[model samples]
Target: MVGCARVVNQTPTLPIKGESYVVLPFENYTETPYAGYRVASILEGVLASKGYNLIPRVWSINERELAVEEIEKLKESAVKNGARYIVHGSVNEFRYKTGLDGEPAVSITIFVYDAKENKVVKNVTVSGSGWVHESLGTLTQKLLNRAF
Candidate 1:
């Protein structure tokens, strides 16, 4: 696990229709970096499929791409790329015993920001025990529902 993000500048309002945006790589606060990338990809696909104008995932993302030191630069890049909103997310993957069963569960949190306002329009956190392959899809849908 790594450092967690300190959220800033939040708003209670949600985004309207037809807003363009980019799905930034979900910050990796877990032991595995690949898990973070997978989370990000899930977010991008879900948001796009739900009818949001999303930036292509493969066209603009990588591990360690958005350092804490580059907040301003990242914001500028997102704006220049025609993103009216920016999606930031994180996950904590863990395993715990539920009665007789030992299962893997993921706790995910996602933030949707209105770029010009620099405010978090939506934030969601969800956790459930299951295989990553299946849980990822459920978590992705939850994030998208909150985001849109």
Candidate 2:
């Protein structure tokens, strides 16, 4: 219960215009230690490919624990970095299926926060499994495409 923040009724399509944003490292709910960072990195590239102005990883060090602490101080940090928004979330699942024909799969939730207002502007969950021959990164990209 802070600021005028509330989840929007609908998630916006990607490449949000006229906004400089930062992709904060995401939480990894999965057992894989690097899954969160891996996905967050991929997401940053995807957003940039789609024409979004994303802050570089060098600016924040891609650390989840640090991001959590920084959320309380997001307004000041965002202002310093010239970022109007922050993207962060969790990787619920990141692994291949357990079967004779295992396929890469991932479940992730993404959120866009209005840094200046300290409010979430959008939230989206995306989950999917790829063909047996697909790589994890490729599968993740497909899932993100489906999400946004």
Best by TM-score: 2
lDDT for predicted candidate 1 compared with the true structure: 0.62
Compared to the true structure, candidate 1 yields what TM-score?
Answer: 0.69
State how far residue 36 of model 2 sits from its true place (Å).
0.9
Over 4 Å off, model 2: 1-15, 58-67, 70-78
- lDDT (Cα atoms) of all candidates against the true structure: 0.62, 0.71
Q: Note each model's CA RMSD in angstroms.
A: 6.9, 8.4
Model 1: colliding residue pairs: none
Predicted structure 1: clash tally: 0
**Residue 80, candidate 2: how far off, in angstroms?**
2.2
Model 2 TM-score relative to the real fold = 0.79
Q: What is the lDDT of residue 111 in candidate 2?
A: 88
TM values, all candidates:
0.69, 0.79
